[model samples]
Target chain A: MSAPVVDLPAYEQARRIRDGELTAVGLLQATLKRTEAVEGQQPSSRPYALDAADLEKVHAFINRTEARALQRAEAIDAALAAGEPTGPLAGVPLAVKDNFCVQGTATTAGSKILENFISPYAATAVERLEQAGAVVVGKVNLDEFTFGSSNESSAFLPPVGNPWNPAHVPGGSSGGSTAAVAAGEASLSLGSDTAGSIRQPAAFCGVVGMKPTYGRVSRYGLIAFASSLDCVGPVARNITDTALMMNVIAGPDRRDATAANLAVPDYLAQLDSDLEGMRIGLSPDYFWLKIFDPTTGVLEEQPISPEIEKAVLEAAELLAGRGATIVEDVPMPNTHMGIPVYFVISRVEAASNLHRYDGVKYGFRYGEDTGDLTELYRKSRGAGFGLQPKLRILMGMYVSAEQYEKGYYERALQARTLIRQDFERAFDPEGQYGLDCLLTATTPTTAFKIGAVYGDSVLMQYADMLTVAANHAGVPGISIPAGLDRGGLPIGIQLLGPDFSESRLLQIGRAYERATEDASWRSIRPIVVRNLP
Target chain B: MTKLSGLQSFMQGSGQKDPASKKTESCFDRRTASRYNDCPEGEEVLLPQYPSRQDDEITPEIFDHLVDLAAFHLEPEEREYLRKELNAQLKAIRELEALDVSPEVPITSHGVPFKAAISAPLREDVIEACPEADDIVAGAPETELRYIVVPDIPHEELE
Candidate 1:
């Protein structure tokens, strides 16, 4: 029999099954078989590439989840037949990033440190999605503790390759979520962004990733990196799926004191609303910053590629043509200070947060005979943590101590204050160019060669400069695949808005996506082969 | 006042000493005491008698007031360090006693700094399920499922 489907959204897949046009068992088996066949072939495609250990782990979950899937499917069918409660996402199968805890599943957060740890409860985001009848396939990979901008920082796996080019990186820490959505491993996925964790990867993998305003979504079950910066959102194949997932995840939760008590809006319904009077602040300041050293004085030292800028600028013009007011000179905050402040605060928090992981009451331990507790701690931490983790821990330790705390840590906090003030001042102004949202490049360039950044700390450091500020300031941001390079790799445009501004941002982003007439995102290919000898 | 710890006194002298005042101190002066009493014999020879910020303006009464104010927030180690720093400043000021001093010499303070507002939002106290603790533990080279086994500390090695 022919494979059950191709390029179908989650809601449509569920609808097909509801109408008896497709069987859940048949679809599941087809997916497993397709995954297996792809594995047997050992292909060099982007989306098809799956780590041996991770693939096995996810397959095991799939096997174990068969009964659960059947039970859920039958319930859905019964509901459809009996005219019972039917949610918009009823019976849809999905995957979620490992950063989110699902009860009965081991949420690894894509780190080896949490290898055997099982979350005792579900993340509020996951709980709501499941409550809406979405069947979670499994947890996806991510950067360790959501720290690095690239998935390569993961202690457990090499970075997820882009779905378009296996040789290129899937920008991360939400790489796995975006990859899953683009590759059709899941109809939709959930990911968290502290910096560009969600958007960067979404842009790289040619999918949609949303980071709702800082307090718009509850961060109850998501692990902390920089608490002030972190936000959880959805990744999906298109604008509608992204909205669907966002509707389920965004809301006030008592579990997270930071969660805003505002009423959740109908994100999907807001898509078609006219944005004729909306003002988008296009900061030329973003393009002027020296992200990378310039080879020539004539050309500004931009981290973004020329083609990528062309795509974004063209889109900006298109937005202007669509009756939106696009002003170019509007400046961003002290964006250059983002990296330093982010590093200090994030590392300081990381050091304190990871302190709980010392081989003790719970987790992996290290040490054999006759030594002190200090030695135990040193050895256990040394052994459990990866190099990046160690570097951050040391950096954080240095910043938190009495000596450097005054100069580095305190200064960073001061800078953060100035940056926040700058943002407030920019947004609070009235008239000609009152800011509804700020626009910028999601990533400086398209996905680069895999293992390319292995030895380059400068490149790695610059990887997050553009996106880190939004995280530091605790604002909402989203990334949509704007266009493609000659290599066919996708470029993303980032839209950052004030706190609690996701619904409007989504509406704006949806209009841009539809108006662009770009379909390079759909060209992303999943790994069709695995298990190479 | 509490006695300053050896480490505290050393740290205070190390950071707070003014180089300008060190040139005037006679090492042989009868009343000029050393802050390096805790230093090893060879190390004590290298200790410089740099001046403190204390003078007639920094009286014992003022010292007591500063100490009381600081006690609320200072850690024991910090208090000891601060006590030494205050004492050093007082001594340095008094070194000017032999010289014809003018009342017009302006005194400066430990500089107070301020930044813009908006403290970090406090994380919710509610405990949500995190990644499996055991999974994190599994990566340890030597660990029991929960606790990291360790060797006993020998008392002789205590610093």
Candidate 2:
């Protein structure tokens, strides 16, 4: 009778609403119904439990904004009825990661410190999305302070399970955002990336995630993990949806000093553009033949998982076949140093940023056990913070200490300069190695079993090794579903370009997606969504 | 072995053994004795418990000092866990020290210096009341009427 509720791409749903072929109320109801059906249910288990008990099992949403969402949907419908102009993403239902502030909603960022913290103001990105007529459904879970790679680091909420296999993890700290999209709970979602938080989770949940060039989106209200590395971006089912979100949220904001003032390109317009003569760089040192061992803390020099290597090679070949040249061995010698550099900078900044939450101004306070002002400060933070955040704070303190500042913190900053130069060298047309974009695997492996990498912090940190370099260089990178592993987990390949080259990256990505549309590997709908009634 | 006897024997052995021999024997004996104390005589010790106290840059004492410096109050177990975790991270950070970075290389605090980009102009600062100031203050745990209530500061500590 009406358009099928589940699995409808964001663009199509928006179009139907825009055309008045489907009412916003009907779309909202259908999306909510579908979300209720599949949000918390384990897809692998038989006999679908449509009961209220099962709904409670869904850990994806930290706070569901049903009333607000319905109200917003009604307003959009009313606007269209009055013959008013609507933005491109009108009537689209989207999820916001809990890290981004949404006024009147609890924005915990998955930490107990902010467990009851209500955002008094919305992030610039959230405000823009809502202004573009997208309805905010809920806030999703993430790692506490976005410190750990796994969503298990969430102290206040249950770890978000991968929709692909409930036994495995939805990669984090943007796990719930990606999981919400993959499970069809939300048509599209917003996530902040500070070293692979967005792309890794999107890869795990089998969705498209883009970390725009640093400063591309305003950080006005997005919770900071690493101020230098953090970039707010979108997670969606397809490139078009991601681009639509970019259209609304990208460009400089007067509120955020770091927001780039570059002209916002129409990402959708460049989707159908030709890729002829586009040079894609491949770094053998960074991408080829390496498997990280959690047990020994070693990144072994062995052939990468055949599936991942095959996916990258095939994508390169596909681009080359479509008139783009594949350039080999672009040197990024300092790429491996990104992890340590990022660790130093991010932790130091986090230590400084988190100092604001010391019980007096806002968020959690622990004055009960206070013997002095300092005790109150200590107890408040110590009691409020989770394991990973505590550890990181200590690490930040160690590196930034006056004694170790020059050797650890200062040297890391210097190394960051070298890393930035490496990317510049690759992108410079007049320089030795000129390239349009670089290609690499998003994760070393597919979504791992939950608790597999949980206990090992080093192993968890290594999850961002492939993705963090882009953040360090402040470049734009997108993770597109390349294929699936034998276990049917999604494998993603990332395309990295110089600063403000998001349009070019999206163009190359769209070309690859189109070429592989008929292929079995294009997009994988998680079993949870596929099994929905 | 009985707990008291184990302690007694360990103390007596340390006193009786020559200092030179004790150095070598303590390495093996302390590990063996600690392992043996945890298990029955016949039970195999899968892995010996090596004392974490070694010639390391980050020791428990230094870790506590750092925790104090950071103004974090970790519980005993949290401190021990972080002592190990921080050491591991520090080991990884030490690798950066090995890099041949010249002192002349400019430090990059932010990824892209948007201030340098002509298009990204700085906003003019203006004095204005925050609309949500009350809402933000309301979110705090302790507030007196309209103001946030904080612990009284000892004036000497401030100095």
Candidate 3:
């Protein structure tokens, strides 16, 4: 058989193969070979894909769906061959991040904490994609409990390395999903975003990822992390793929209390909308807050990259050229407290939500503690949680301390109210600074060398700084490939919309994406650094 | 004066060092002290409330008093919100303050409820295989018996 189809989008390859231009067995073989070559190249590290016997088992499972997938593919091919019709992602093979519970598959969320855990039911989002006939390859990796911004927090698995620059981190806790899509291992992967888990990796790996409005999609089976901030979204090779996936997965679930009780819009159906009359706000103050205090009119030391600033300015112009009213003089309130506020709120929720991992009812349990039960709990937690998770737990616990209540927890809550109010006032039609969507740079800087996050606190801090406000405000933020930096690493232009206004955000992104012809920004990727043990 | 271990006495006697010792001490009498040791302090204790100033210090014992004070003075909505905030903060402290639970009872940590519904469908009896097993296994550092293996855990640790 021709080697498994390697290095192509699953949908594209599947369609071509089904039309007699490619073969499924050949594609599987090539993918296996590529995975093997990648493994051999890094003899010291874990492999990126499963093995020969596992492949056989996988094939045996695929064999059950292979007939149906092939029939559907053939039908699509027949339609295409006869000048009939097909869906955009018809016959594509994709995978959902393990945070999503696919029927019968263990949804581990990348922690040994729940390695043996299986979902008796499929998540509503996964079910939607399955209904659309996307063949799920397998659950990808992630941070434990989707807790860390980097994939390293995973309790059971190694960090998901960026495919191009294996040494640099693939942004996480959706790092594996981003890596899988970027490395051509999967065409589309669904990952949860809380505090930029999806967008950060998308920027790092040079892929397209979207964090839809909170409650836009159901969280029925998503293992909770900061419930109010978590959102299930798509990561794909490009914006179109992201939009296509969004169309399938965006909706409400009766079981999810927080899910928005609104009708799901056809995301792809409106992809071609023009931004001619739309107003896109370029918040110079919001973008430059790290440097300047516009209210005080003083320059500061937040040292932003000249490279990124230039690209963002150009992105605004590009949108303006596409018939959009680009307003650059608009100012939003300072978001200086966003990161701190996000940490407190997220930790508080995390502290409360994560109390379930106690080895009593589920997952890993330690019986080694013959000591007092309290010590057993502390030791179990100290042993079970990774550094990041522990840090958050500690931070949350500290803030929630009785004496510290008003000083920290309530203060953080009040700060969140102020941030939300700022967003509301900015987007208010009758307010002083009314605007449609607020645009800002996704990252202060481009992808650095992998492992750099361990050293540079500011770099790591600013990584999610741009995305956290939306999480705090409970609004939608979309990150589009803006323009590349001097080093050719991709830069993302982030657009924030009023709550429940994801449709407008996507429209604005699509318009600008169409206007920009910077193909190089899309082509260049991260520098790979491989580590094998 | 009830008989107690050194640690218990150290904890109980430590509170007498505070200024409100007389008011706090009498309440910690034999019957109350026994129940208070394991009981959550926020829900169980009562004391003279701290002043309504936002920045006032809140001890574990003072929290219950604060709640009562809030109930007496604030509007219903205001009291409810403050109660939630206070209770949440107290619960976090209590988790830390709680002496280790016994080995038979695991210290519950993660708040995620990972339960499958009783009415949930059963897994198909026929084994379903992985389509990307080769791709997945390609990344495993070590493998044996078709499973991605790792350094063996010391069997005795059991957690």
Candidate of highest lDDT = 2
lDDT at B95, model 2: 56
Q: Write the per-residue lDDT of candidate 1 for residues A302-384, one digit (tens) a residue.
A: 33456667877887877777668887787664675566566677777777777776655444456464166655555555555
Which structure is stronger by TM-score: 2 or 3? 2
RMSD of each: 16.7, 9.8, 17.2
**Which segments of model 1 are wrong by more than 4 Å?**
A1-6, A17-27, A37-71, A78-82, A291-300, A367-372, A429-432, A518-533, B1-159
Highest TM-score among the candidates is held by which one?
2
What TM-score against the true chain A does chain A of each candidate get? 0.88, 0.94, 0.83
Q: Report the candidate with higher lDDT, 1 versus 2.
A: 2
Q: Model 2, residue A248: what's the lDDT?
A: 88
By lDDT rank, best first, the candidates go: 2, 1, 3
Q: What are the Cα lDDT values of the candidates? A: 0.60, 0.76, 0.57
Among all candidates shown, the one with the greatest DockQ: 2
Q: What does candidate 3's lDDT look like per residue over A1-533, in tens digits?
A: 23234545555675675566864445544544444444222111122232222211111010012334445455555665676545555556665777787765666776655655556677888777766756566677777778666564465433456665554456677877777666655678888888888888777666777888777788887888888678898888766677778878876566676566667777767777887677778776556644222223333434235666777788888788878787667655546556656656787788778777654444444446325444444444544554445445545665776886656566666566656766787788887766789888776656543332321112234457677877777777877777655444566778888866777877777777777646555544433212211
Off by over 4 Å in 2: A1-3, A41-58, A289-302, A367-369, A522-524, B1-51, B157-159
- Would you estimate the TM-scores of all the predictions? 0.72, 0.88, 0.67
Q: Give the chain B TM-score for each candidate.
A: 0.25, 0.58, 0.21
Q: Rank the candidates by TM-score, best first.
A: 2, 1, 3
Of 1 and 3, the candidate ahead on DockQ is 1
- Model 1 per-residue lDDT tens digits across residues B14-43: 222222322222121111112112222332
